[model samples]
Target chain A: MAASASASAARPLAGDSLTIHVSSRPQLAMVSALPRSSPPTWRLGLGRPARLSTRSPHARSVRCLAAGGGLAPEMRATLDKVVASHKVVLFMKGTKDFPQCGFSHTVVQILRSLDVPFETLDVLANEALRQGLKDYSSWPTFPQLYIDGEFFGGCDITVEAYKSGELQETLEKAMCS
Target chain B: MGVTKEDVETAITSSLSPSHLVVTDTSGGCGASYEIEVVSEKFEGKRLLERHRMVNTALAPHMAEIHAVSIKKVLTPAQAQPQPEPAADKAQA
Candidate 1:
Protein backbone atom coordinates (compact mmCIF):
# COMPACT_ATOMS: atom_id res chain seq x y z
CA MET A 1 0.00 0.00 0.00
CA ALA A 2 2.79 2.46 0.85
CA ALA A 3 4.73 1.61 -2.29
CA SER A 4 1.61 2.07 -4.47
CA ALA A 5 0.95 5.54 -2.95
CA SER A 6 4.56 6.63 -3.50
CA ALA A 7 4.47 5.45 -7.13
CA SER A 8 1.21 7.28 -7.76
CA ALA A 9 2.64 10.54 -6.45
CA ALA A 10 5.80 10.13 -8.56
CA ARG A 11 3.70 9.41 -11.65
CA PRO A 12 2.01 12.84 -11.49
CA LEU A 13 5.33 14.59 -10.91
CA ALA A 14 6.85 12.90 -13.96
CA GLY A 15 3.82 13.81 -16.08
CA ASP A 16 4.03 17.43 -14.94
CA SER A 17 7.71 17.69 -15.88
CA LEU A 18 7.03 16.00 -19.23
CA THR A 19 4.31 18.54 -20.02
CA ILE A 20 6.63 21.41 -19.13
CA HIS A 21 9.37 19.96 -21.34
CA VAL A 22 7.02 19.55 -24.32
CA SER A 23 5.59 23.05 -24.02
CA SER A 24 9.02 24.65 -23.59
CA ARG A 25 10.43 22.98 -26.70
CA PRO A 26 8.35 25.18 -29.00
CA GLN A 27 9.37 28.34 -27.17
CA LEU A 28 13.03 27.43 -27.61
CA ALA A 29 12.48 26.87 -31.32
CA MET A 30 10.66 30.21 -31.57
CA VAL A 31 13.50 32.09 -29.83
CA SER A 32 16.12 30.50 -32.04
CA ALA A 33 14.15 31.15 -35.24
CA LEU A 34 13.45 34.82 -34.37
CA PRO A 35 16.88 36.20 -35.37
CA ARG A 36 16.94 34.61 -38.81
CA SER A 37 16.91 37.76 -41.01
CA SER A 38 15.46 36.14 -44.10
CA PRO A 39 12.09 34.62 -43.42
CA PRO A 40 11.47 31.16 -44.86
CA THR A 41 8.62 32.42 -47.01
CA TRP A 42 9.41 29.74 -49.53
CA ARG A 43 7.98 27.19 -47.14
CA LEU A 44 4.60 28.69 -47.95
CA GLY A 45 2.00 26.64 -49.93
CA LEU A 46 3.79 23.39 -49.09
CA GLY A 47 2.96 20.46 -46.79
CA ARG A 48 0.53 22.53 -44.73
CA PRO A 49 -2.98 21.20 -44.79
CA ALA A 50 -5.48 23.96 -45.46
CA ARG A 51 -7.17 22.99 -42.21
CA LEU A 52 -5.68 21.14 -39.27
CA SER A 53 -7.42 17.76 -39.16
CA THR A 54 -7.38 17.07 -35.40
CA ARG A 55 -5.01 19.37 -33.50
CA SER A 56 -2.00 17.32 -34.54
CA PRO A 57 1.41 17.56 -32.91
CA HIS A 58 2.67 19.29 -36.09
CA ALA A 59 0.31 22.20 -35.33
CA ARG A 60 2.63 23.79 -32.75
CA SER A 61 5.72 23.52 -34.94
CA VAL A 62 3.83 24.94 -37.91
CA ARG A 63 2.57 27.80 -35.81
CA CYS A 64 6.07 28.43 -34.45
CA LEU A 65 7.43 28.58 -37.99
CA ALA A 66 4.66 30.94 -38.98
CA ALA A 67 5.26 33.19 -35.97
CA GLY A 68 8.98 33.40 -36.76
CA GLY A 69 8.31 34.80 -40.24
CA GLY A 70 5.55 37.18 -39.29
CA LEU A 71 1.92 36.20 -40.07
CA ALA A 72 2.40 33.50 -42.65
CA PRO A 73 -0.46 32.74 -45.00
CA GLU A 74 -0.63 29.19 -43.66
CA MET A 75 -1.21 30.56 -40.19
CA ARG A 76 -4.04 32.70 -41.53
CA ALA A 77 -5.64 29.61 -43.04
CA THR A 78 -5.48 27.76 -39.73
CA LEU A 79 -7.03 30.69 -37.88
CA ASP A 80 -9.76 30.98 -40.47
CA LYS A 81 -10.74 27.37 -39.94
CA VAL A 82 -10.67 27.80 -36.16
CA VAL A 83 -12.89 30.90 -36.14
CA ALA A 84 -15.40 29.31 -38.47
CA SER A 85 -15.45 26.01 -36.59
CA HIS A 86 -18.36 27.03 -34.39
CA LYS A 87 -21.19 29.53 -34.21
CA VAL A 88 -19.59 31.20 -31.18
CA VAL A 89 -15.83 31.06 -30.64
CA LEU A 90 -13.78 32.91 -28.06
CA PHE A 91 -10.00 33.10 -28.47
CA MET A 92 -9.14 33.89 -24.90
CA LYS A 93 -6.19 33.72 -22.55
CA GLY A 94 -7.46 30.54 -20.91
CA THR A 95 -10.21 27.96 -21.16
CA LYS A 96 -13.81 28.86 -20.40
CA ASP A 97 -13.73 27.31 -16.92
CA PHE A 98 -10.21 28.57 -16.13
CA PRO A 99 -9.63 32.09 -17.44
CA GLN A 100 -6.07 33.30 -16.75
CA CYS A 101 -6.72 37.01 -17.20
CA GLY A 102 -9.33 39.31 -15.67
CA PHE A 103 -10.60 40.54 -19.04
CA SER A 104 -10.87 36.97 -20.27
CA HIS A 105 -12.69 35.99 -17.10
CA THR A 106 -15.17 38.85 -17.48
CA VAL A 107 -15.99 37.83 -21.02
CA VAL A 108 -16.33 34.18 -19.99
CA GLN A 109 -18.76 35.19 -17.26
CA ILE A 110 -20.80 37.31 -19.65
CA LEU A 111 -21.07 34.45 -22.10
CA ARG A 112 -22.03 32.08 -19.32
CA SER A 113 -24.70 34.50 -18.11
CA LEU A 114 -26.02 34.74 -21.65
CA ASP A 115 -26.34 30.93 -21.55
CA VAL A 116 -24.83 30.52 -24.94
CA PRO A 117 -22.76 27.50 -25.91
CA PHE A 118 -19.36 28.71 -27.07
CA GLU A 119 -15.90 27.33 -27.80
CA THR A 120 -12.75 28.80 -26.28
CA LEU A 121 -9.13 28.48 -27.45
CA ASP A 122 -6.53 29.03 -24.76
CA VAL A 123 -3.82 31.31 -26.19
CA LEU A 124 -1.59 30.77 -23.17
CA ALA A 125 -0.95 27.16 -24.19
CA ASN A 126 0.37 28.06 -27.61
CA GLU A 127 2.55 31.13 -28.08
CA ALA A 128 2.45 31.00 -31.89
CA LEU A 129 -1.32 30.86 -31.98
CA ARG A 130 -1.42 33.80 -29.58
CA GLN A 131 0.75 35.95 -31.83
CA GLY A 132 -0.98 34.70 -34.97
CA LEU A 133 -4.38 35.60 -33.56
CA LYS A 134 -3.33 39.16 -32.70
CA ASP A 135 -2.49 39.66 -36.37
CA TYR A 136 -5.45 37.62 -37.58
CA SER A 137 -8.00 39.70 -35.70
CA SER A 138 -5.97 42.91 -35.80
CA TRP A 139 -7.35 43.34 -32.29
CA PRO A 140 -4.66 43.85 -29.65
CA THR A 141 -6.47 42.14 -26.81
CA PHE A 142 -7.65 38.71 -25.79
CA PRO A 143 -11.17 37.45 -25.11
CA GLN A 144 -11.85 38.06 -28.81
CA LEU A 145 -15.38 36.89 -29.43
CA TYR A 146 -16.53 35.63 -32.78
CA ILE A 147 -20.20 35.20 -33.62
CA ASP A 148 -21.14 33.46 -36.86
CA GLY A 149 -17.66 33.61 -38.33
CA GLU A 150 -17.33 37.34 -37.64
CA PHE A 151 -14.92 39.10 -35.33
CA PHE A 152 -17.42 40.39 -32.74
CA GLY A 153 -15.07 42.32 -30.42
CA GLY A 154 -13.18 42.00 -27.12
CA CYS A 155 -14.44 41.95 -23.52
CA ASP A 156 -15.54 45.60 -23.27
CA ILE A 157 -17.53 45.42 -26.49
CA THR A 158 -19.09 42.12 -25.40
CA VAL A 159 -20.11 43.69 -22.06
CA GLU A 160 -21.56 46.75 -23.80
CA ALA A 161 -23.40 44.59 -26.28
CA TYR A 162 -24.71 42.41 -23.47
CA LYS A 163 -25.92 45.50 -21.63
CA SER A 164 -27.57 47.03 -24.71
CA GLY A 165 -29.34 43.79 -25.73
CA GLU A 166 -27.61 43.86 -29.08
CA LEU A 167 -25.58 40.77 -28.26
CA GLN A 168 -28.68 38.72 -27.62
CA GLU A 169 -30.28 39.98 -30.78
CA THR A 170 -27.19 39.14 -32.79
CA LEU A 171 -26.88 35.76 -31.08
CA GLU A 172 -30.50 34.98 -31.85
CA LYS A 173 -29.86 35.76 -35.47
CA ALA A 174 -26.74 33.62 -35.48
CA MET A 175 -28.55 30.72 -33.82
CA CYS A 176 -31.36 30.92 -36.29
CA SER A 177 -28.92 30.96 -39.16
CA MET B 1 8.51 51.40 -18.00
CA GLY B 2 5.14 51.62 -19.77
CA VAL B 3 3.03 54.14 -21.66
CA THR B 4 1.49 57.11 -19.84
CA LYS B 5 -2.16 58.19 -19.95
CA GLU B 6 -1.06 61.38 -21.73
CA ASP B 7 0.78 59.35 -24.36
CA VAL B 8 -2.36 57.32 -25.10
CA GLU B 9 -4.42 60.51 -25.28
CA THR B 10 -1.99 62.14 -27.69
CA ALA B 11 -1.90 59.09 -29.93
CA ILE B 12 -5.69 58.91 -30.14
CA THR B 13 -6.01 62.68 -30.52
CA SER B 14 -3.57 62.82 -33.42
CA SER B 15 -4.94 59.77 -35.16
CA LEU B 16 -8.72 60.04 -34.67
CA SER B 17 -9.10 63.71 -33.69
CA PRO B 18 -11.78 62.89 -31.15
CA SER B 19 -14.09 65.65 -30.00
CA HIS B 20 -14.16 64.03 -26.55
CA LEU B 21 -11.60 61.68 -25.07
CA VAL B 22 -10.85 60.22 -21.67
CA VAL B 23 -7.83 58.06 -20.88
CA THR B 24 -7.65 56.64 -17.39
CA ASP B 25 -4.60 54.78 -16.16
CA THR B 26 -5.97 51.67 -14.49
CA SER B 27 -2.55 50.08 -13.86
CA GLY B 28 -1.94 51.86 -10.55
CA GLY B 29 0.99 53.99 -11.75
CA CYS B 30 2.52 51.18 -13.80
CA GLY B 31 0.83 52.65 -16.91
CA ALA B 32 0.35 49.15 -18.40
CA SER B 33 -3.42 49.38 -18.38
CA TYR B 34 -5.96 52.02 -19.39
CA GLU B 35 -9.66 52.68 -19.84
CA ILE B 36 -10.50 54.96 -22.77
CA GLU B 37 -13.66 56.67 -23.89
CA VAL B 38 -13.42 58.40 -27.23
CA VAL B 39 -16.01 60.31 -29.24
CA SER B 40 -14.87 61.27 -32.69
CA GLU B 41 -16.46 62.12 -36.01
CA LYS B 42 -14.15 59.46 -37.45
CA PHE B 43 -16.24 56.83 -35.68
CA GLU B 44 -19.30 57.91 -37.65
CA GLY B 45 -20.83 55.00 -39.57
CA LYS B 46 -18.17 52.60 -38.33
CA ARG B 47 -19.16 49.47 -36.39
CA LEU B 48 -18.08 49.05 -32.77
CA LEU B 49 -15.32 46.64 -33.82
CA GLU B 50 -13.97 49.11 -36.34
CA ARG B 51 -14.08 51.95 -33.86
CA HIS B 52 -12.15 49.83 -31.37
CA ARG B 53 -9.73 48.90 -34.14
CA MET B 54 -9.13 52.57 -34.81
CA VAL B 55 -8.20 53.05 -31.17
CA ASN B 56 -5.99 49.96 -31.25
CA THR B 57 -4.27 51.15 -34.37
CA ALA B 58 -3.74 54.57 -32.86
CA LEU B 59 -2.13 52.96 -29.82
CA ALA B 60 -0.24 50.35 -31.85
CA PRO B 61 3.11 51.92 -31.06
CA HIS B 62 2.59 51.73 -27.31
CA MET B 63 0.53 48.53 -27.19
CA ALA B 64 3.61 46.38 -26.60
CA GLU B 65 4.30 48.02 -23.27
CA ILE B 66 0.64 48.43 -22.31
CA HIS B 67 -0.84 45.20 -20.97
CA ALA B 68 -4.54 45.94 -20.89
CA VAL B 69 -6.65 48.47 -22.77
CA SER B 70 -10.34 48.61 -21.95
CA ILE B 71 -12.04 50.75 -24.58
CA LYS B 72 -15.08 51.61 -22.50
CA LYS B 73 -16.73 53.74 -25.13
CA VAL B 74 -16.30 54.58 -28.79
CA LEU B 75 -18.88 56.81 -30.35
CA THR B 76 -19.36 59.43 -33.03
CA PRO B 77 -20.03 63.01 -31.90
CA ALA B 78 -23.63 62.56 -33.07
CA GLN B 79 -24.10 59.30 -31.16
CA ALA B 80 -22.61 60.83 -28.04
CA GLN B 81 -25.38 63.45 -27.86
CA PRO B 82 -27.95 62.96 -25.11
CA GLN B 83 -31.27 61.75 -26.47
CA PRO B 84 -34.55 63.40 -25.43
CA GLU B 85 -36.32 61.24 -22.85
CA PRO B 86 -39.77 60.43 -24.18
CA ALA B 87 -40.46 58.27 -21.09
CA ALA B 88 -40.90 61.40 -18.93
CA ASP B 89 -43.58 62.76 -21.26
CA LYS B 90 -45.37 59.37 -21.27
CA ALA B 91 -45.28 59.27 -17.46
CA GLN B 92 -46.86 62.76 -17.25
CA ALA B 93 -49.57 61.70 -19.64
Candidate 2:
Protein backbone atom coordinates (compact mmCIF):
# COMPACT_ATOMS: atom_id res chain seq x y z
CA MET A 1 0.00 0.00 0.00
CA ALA A 2 2.84 2.34 0.89
CA ALA A 3 4.70 1.58 -2.34
CA SER A 4 1.55 2.15 -4.43
CA ALA A 5 0.92 5.47 -2.64
CA SER A 6 4.49 6.60 -3.32
CA ALA A 7 4.32 5.46 -6.94
CA SER A 8 1.11 7.48 -7.51
CA ALA A 9 2.72 10.50 -5.87
CA ALA A 10 5.76 10.22 -8.16
CA ARG A 11 3.64 10.31 -11.33
CA PRO A 12 4.02 13.42 -13.59
CA LEU A 13 1.67 16.47 -13.80
CA ALA A 14 -0.51 14.62 -16.38
CA GLY A 15 -2.02 12.54 -13.50
CA ASP A 16 -3.06 15.77 -11.70
CA SER A 17 -5.63 16.65 -14.38
CA LEU A 18 -7.24 13.20 -14.11
CA THR A 19 -7.46 13.60 -10.31
CA ILE A 20 -9.17 16.97 -10.72
CA HIS A 21 -11.69 15.55 -13.17
CA VAL A 22 -12.52 12.60 -10.85
CA SER A 23 -13.08 14.99 -7.94
CA SER A 24 -15.35 17.30 -9.97
CA ARG A 25 -17.43 14.49 -11.46
CA PRO A 26 -17.70 12.26 -8.40
CA GLN A 27 -21.19 10.95 -9.19
CA LEU A 28 -20.15 9.98 -12.72
CA ALA A 29 -17.00 8.32 -11.46
CA MET A 30 -18.97 6.32 -8.88
CA VAL A 31 -21.60 5.25 -11.41
CA SER A 32 -19.00 4.08 -13.89
CA ALA A 33 -16.81 2.41 -11.27
CA LEU A 34 -19.73 0.60 -9.56
CA PRO A 35 -20.18 -2.12 -12.18
CA ARG A 36 -16.59 -3.28 -11.94
CA SER A 37 -16.29 -3.11 -8.14
CA SER A 38 -19.53 -4.51 -6.66
CA PRO A 39 -22.19 -5.77 -9.05
CA PRO A 40 -22.65 -9.27 -7.65
CA THR A 41 -23.41 -8.23 -4.08
CA TRP A 42 -25.94 -5.66 -5.28
CA ARG A 43 -27.64 -8.20 -7.55
CA LEU A 44 -27.78 -10.96 -4.92
CA GLY A 45 -29.46 -8.84 -2.27
CA LEU A 46 -31.92 -6.68 -4.22
CA GLY A 47 -32.54 -9.11 -7.15
CA ARG A 48 -32.98 -6.10 -9.42
CA PRO A 49 -31.18 -6.09 -12.74
CA ALA A 50 -27.93 -4.15 -12.59
CA ARG A 51 -28.14 -0.56 -13.84
CA LEU A 52 -25.76 -1.23 -16.72
CA SER A 53 -27.75 -0.36 -19.81
CA THR A 54 -30.14 2.41 -18.71
CA ARG A 55 -27.75 4.59 -16.79
CA SER A 56 -29.07 8.01 -17.82
CA PRO A 57 -32.77 7.32 -17.35
CA HIS A 58 -32.08 5.50 -14.10
CA ALA A 59 -30.08 8.47 -12.82
CA ARG A 60 -32.86 10.91 -13.77
CA SER A 61 -35.47 8.85 -11.91
CA VAL A 62 -33.25 8.70 -8.85
CA ARG A 63 -33.08 12.51 -8.82
CA CYS A 64 -36.87 12.63 -8.97
CA LEU A 65 -37.00 10.29 -6.00
CA ALA A 66 -34.59 12.53 -4.13
CA ALA A 67 -36.90 15.46 -4.75
CA GLY A 68 -39.68 13.40 -3.19
CA GLY A 69 -37.57 12.64 -0.05
CA GLY A 70 -36.12 9.54 -1.72
CA LEU A 71 -32.49 8.88 -2.53
CA ALA A 72 -30.54 10.29 -5.41
CA PRO A 73 -29.19 7.53 -7.67
CA GLU A 74 -25.62 8.10 -6.59
CA MET A 75 -26.69 8.06 -2.94
CA ARG A 76 -28.88 5.03 -3.61
CA ALA A 77 -26.03 3.24 -5.35
CA THR A 78 -23.66 4.20 -2.56
CA LEU A 79 -26.12 2.86 0.04
CA ASP A 80 -26.45 -0.31 -2.03
CA LYS A 81 -22.72 -0.79 -1.80
CA VAL A 82 -22.64 0.15 1.91
CA VAL A 83 -25.31 -2.30 3.06
CA ALA A 84 -23.97 -5.08 0.86
CA SER A 85 -20.42 -4.56 2.05
CA HIS A 86 -21.18 -5.34 5.68
CA LYS A 87 -22.79 -8.24 7.52
CA VAL A 88 -24.68 -5.66 9.56
CA VAL A 89 -25.24 -1.92 9.08
CA LEU A 90 -27.12 0.60 11.22
CA PHE A 91 -28.25 4.07 10.17
CA MET A 92 -29.00 5.84 13.39
CA LYS A 93 -29.21 9.31 14.98
CA GLY A 94 -25.71 9.10 16.38
CA THR A 95 -22.64 6.91 16.70
CA LYS A 96 -22.77 3.59 18.53
CA ASP A 97 -20.93 4.97 21.54
CA PHE A 98 -22.86 8.23 21.73
CA PRO A 99 -26.38 7.78 20.46
CA GLN A 100 -28.43 10.98 20.20
CA CYS A 101 -31.85 9.41 20.52
CA GLY A 102 -33.26 7.08 23.15
CA PHE A 103 -34.52 4.69 20.48
CA SER A 104 -31.18 4.69 18.75
CA HIS A 105 -29.45 3.96 22.06
CA THR A 106 -31.71 0.98 22.69
CA VAL A 107 -30.90 -0.57 19.34
CA VAL A 108 -27.19 -0.10 19.94
CA GLN A 109 -27.44 -1.84 23.30
CA ILE A 110 -29.32 -4.77 21.82
CA LEU A 111 -26.71 -5.19 19.09
CA ARG A 112 -23.94 -5.04 21.64
CA SER A 113 -25.68 -7.64 23.78
CA LEU A 114 -25.87 -9.88 20.74
CA ASP A 115 -22.09 -9.46 20.41
CA VAL A 116 -21.94 -9.19 16.65
CA PRO A 117 -19.80 -6.88 14.57
CA PHE A 118 -21.86 -4.07 13.09
CA GLU A 119 -21.28 -0.80 11.28
CA THR A 120 -23.20 2.41 12.00
CA LEU A 121 -23.82 5.58 10.01
CA ASP A 122 -24.89 8.70 11.93
CA VAL A 123 -27.85 10.24 10.11
CA LEU A 124 -27.99 13.35 12.29
CA ALA A 125 -24.72 14.49 10.72
CA ASN A 126 -26.03 14.29 7.17
CA GLU A 127 -29.37 15.91 6.28
CA ALA A 128 -29.66 14.43 2.81
CA LEU A 129 -28.98 10.87 3.98
CA ARG A 130 -31.36 11.25 6.92
CA GLN A 131 -34.27 12.15 4.63
CA GLY A 132 -33.27 9.84 1.80
CA LEU A 133 -33.12 6.83 4.15
CA LYS A 134 -36.77 7.14 5.15
CA ASP A 135 -37.77 6.71 1.50
CA TYR A 136 -35.15 4.04 0.90
CA SER A 137 -36.37 1.83 3.72
CA SER A 138 -40.02 2.89 3.50
CA TRP A 139 -39.82 3.27 7.24
CA PRO A 140 -40.13 6.75 8.78
CA THR A 141 -38.07 6.10 11.89
CA PHE A 142 -34.38 6.06 12.58
CA PRO A 143 -32.01 3.48 14.05
CA GLN A 144 -32.70 1.40 10.96
CA LEU A 145 -30.95 -1.94 11.01
CA TYR A 146 -29.81 -3.98 8.03
CA ILE A 147 -28.76 -7.60 8.23
CA ASP A 148 -27.43 -9.50 5.23
CA GLY A 149 -27.99 -6.46 3.01
CA GLU A 150 -31.70 -6.55 3.83
CA PHE A 151 -33.52 -4.00 6.02
CA PHE A 152 -34.50 -5.79 9.22
CA GLY A 153 -36.46 -2.96 10.88
CA GLY A 154 -36.18 -0.10 13.33
CA CYS A 155 -35.80 -0.01 17.16
CA ASP A 156 -39.14 -1.51 18.17
CA ILE A 157 -38.90 -4.35 15.69
CA THR A 158 -35.33 -5.01 16.65
CA VAL A 159 -36.21 -5.14 20.34
CA GLU A 160 -39.14 -7.49 19.68
CA ALA A 161 -36.96 -9.72 17.55
CA TYR A 162 -34.31 -9.72 20.25
CA LYS A 163 -36.80 -10.72 22.94
CA SER A 164 -37.90 -13.71 20.88
CA GLY A 165 -34.34 -14.88 20.07
CA GLU A 166 -35.15 -14.37 16.41
CA LEU A 167 -32.46 -11.72 16.11
CA GLN A 168 -29.78 -14.06 17.38
CA GLU A 169 -30.94 -16.78 15.03
CA THR A 170 -30.95 -14.41 12.08
CA LEU A 171 -27.54 -13.02 12.96
CA GLU A 172 -26.18 -16.55 13.18
CA LYS A 173 -27.59 -17.31 9.76
CA ALA A 174 -26.09 -14.14 8.29
CA MET A 175 -22.77 -14.88 9.93
CA CYS A 176 -22.60 -18.26 8.28
CA SER A 177 -23.82 -17.10 4.90
CA MET B 1 -50.35 23.30 15.58
CA GLY B 2 -48.97 19.70 15.74
CA VAL B 3 -50.65 16.30 15.55
CA THR B 4 -52.85 15.22 18.45
CA LYS B 5 -53.39 11.93 20.24
CA GLU B 6 -56.98 11.98 19.09
CA ASP B 7 -55.96 12.57 15.52
CA VAL B 8 -53.61 9.59 15.68
CA GLU B 9 -56.28 7.43 17.30
CA THR B 10 -58.90 8.43 14.78
CA ALA B 11 -56.61 7.72 11.84
CA ILE B 12 -55.55 4.27 13.05
CA THR B 13 -59.03 3.37 14.21
CA SER B 14 -60.66 4.35 10.92
CA SER B 15 -58.01 2.62 8.88
CA LEU B 16 -57.27 -0.56 10.84
CA SER B 17 -60.41 -0.87 12.96
CA PRO B 18 -58.17 -2.16 15.70
CA SER B 19 -59.82 -4.16 18.49
CA HIS B 20 -57.42 -2.86 21.10
CA LEU B 21 -55.65 0.48 20.69
CA VAL B 22 -53.60 2.65 22.97
CA VAL B 23 -52.06 5.95 21.94
CA THR B 24 -49.90 7.61 24.58
CA ASP B 25 -48.82 11.15 23.86
CA THR B 26 -45.23 10.73 24.95
CA SER B 27 -44.40 14.17 23.67
CA GLY B 28 -46.34 15.65 26.60
CA GLY B 29 -48.80 18.08 24.94
CA CYS B 30 -46.91 18.87 21.74
CA GLY B 31 -48.17 15.71 19.95
CA ALA B 32 -44.78 15.32 18.30
CA SER B 33 -44.11 11.95 19.94
CA TYR B 34 -46.36 8.99 20.65
CA GLU B 35 -46.26 5.35 21.63
CA ILE B 36 -48.93 3.13 20.17
CA GLU B 37 -50.19 -0.39 20.76
CA VAL B 38 -52.66 -1.71 18.26
CA VAL B 39 -54.39 -5.03 17.59
CA SER B 40 -56.38 -5.58 14.44
CA GLU B 41 -57.45 -8.21 11.92
CA LYS B 42 -55.54 -6.35 9.23
CA PHE B 43 -52.33 -7.64 10.81
CA GLU B 44 -53.48 -11.27 10.75
CA GLY B 45 -51.22 -12.49 7.96
CA LYS B 46 -48.56 -9.80 8.20
CA ARG B 47 -45.12 -9.68 9.77
CA LEU B 48 -44.16 -7.18 12.45
CA LEU B 49 -42.65 -4.81 9.92
CA GLU B 50 -45.75 -4.89 7.74
CA ARG B 51 -47.98 -4.29 10.74
CA HIS B 52 -45.95 -1.20 11.64
CA ARG B 53 -46.22 -0.06 8.04
CA MET B 54 -50.00 -0.23 8.21
CA VAL B 55 -50.03 2.01 11.26
CA ASN B 56 -47.52 4.35 9.61
CA THR B 57 -49.60 4.59 6.44
CA ALA B 58 -52.65 5.40 8.50
CA LEU B 59 -50.73 8.18 10.21
CA ALA B 60 -49.00 9.41 7.03
CA PRO B 61 -50.88 12.71 6.83
CA HIS B 62 -49.98 13.65 10.39
CA MET B 63 -46.42 12.34 10.11
CA ALA B 64 -45.08 15.66 8.90
CA GLU B 65 -46.05 17.31 12.18
CA ILE B 66 -45.19 14.37 14.40
CA HIS B 67 -41.53 14.02 15.14
CA ALA B 68 -41.49 10.59 16.72
CA VAL B 69 -43.78 7.56 16.61
CA SER B 70 -42.81 4.51 18.58
CA ILE B 71 -45.01 1.59 17.56
CA LYS B 72 -44.74 -0.41 20.75
CA LYS B 73 -47.03 -3.26 19.80
CA VAL B 74 -48.51 -4.56 16.55
CA LEU B 75 -50.70 -7.60 17.00
CA THR B 76 -53.62 -9.45 15.49
CA PRO B 77 -56.64 -10.04 17.73
CA ALA B 78 -55.86 -13.72 18.17
CA GLN B 79 -52.26 -13.06 19.13
CA ALA B 80 -53.34 -10.38 21.57
CA GLN B 81 -55.82 -12.66 23.34
CA PRO B 82 -53.21 -14.66 25.23
CA GLN B 83 -51.45 -11.68 26.88
CA PRO B 84 -53.22 -9.18 29.07
CA GLU B 85 -50.14 -7.29 30.14
CA PRO B 86 -48.57 -4.41 28.21
CA ALA B 87 -45.52 -6.18 26.75
CA ALA B 88 -44.09 -2.89 25.53
CA ASP B 89 -43.36 -1.54 29.00
CA LYS B 90 -41.41 -4.67 29.92
CA ALA B 91 -39.54 -4.59 26.61
CA GLN B 92 -38.50 -0.97 27.05
CA ALA B 93 -37.05 -1.65 30.49
What is each predicted model's overall lDDT from 0 to 1? 0.68, 0.69
Q: What TM-score, computed on C-alpha atoms, does each candidate reach?
A: 0.71, 0.75
Per-residue accuracy of model 2 over B42-86 as CA lDDT, tens digit each: 999998878887888899888889989999889998998887766
For A1-177, candidate 2 gives per-residue lDDT tens digits of 111112223122111122211101223333355433222332112323234423323121111122123233334455555555567888898788889999999999999988998888888876656765676666777989988767788898999999999999989998987
Which ranges of candidate 2 are over 4 A from the true structure? A1-70, B86-93
Model 1, span A1-177: residue lDDT tens: 111122223232221122221211222222222213332234334334233333323222222122122345444444554565566888888777778999999988988898988888788886666766676666778988888766788998999899999999988888887
What tens digits encode model 1's per-residue C-alpha lDDT throughout B5-86?
8999999999999997878888899999998888899998988877888898899999999999998778887877774634
How many pairs of residues collide in each model? 0, 0
Estimate how well candidate 1 is docked, as a DockQ score: 0.75
Query: Deviation in angstroms for A81 in model 2?
Result: 0.8
User: Against the true two-chain complex, what DockQ does each candidate achieve?
Assistant: 0.75, 0.63
Query: What is the Å distance of residue A62 in model 2 from its true position?
Result: 16
Native contacts retained per candidate? 1.00, 0.75
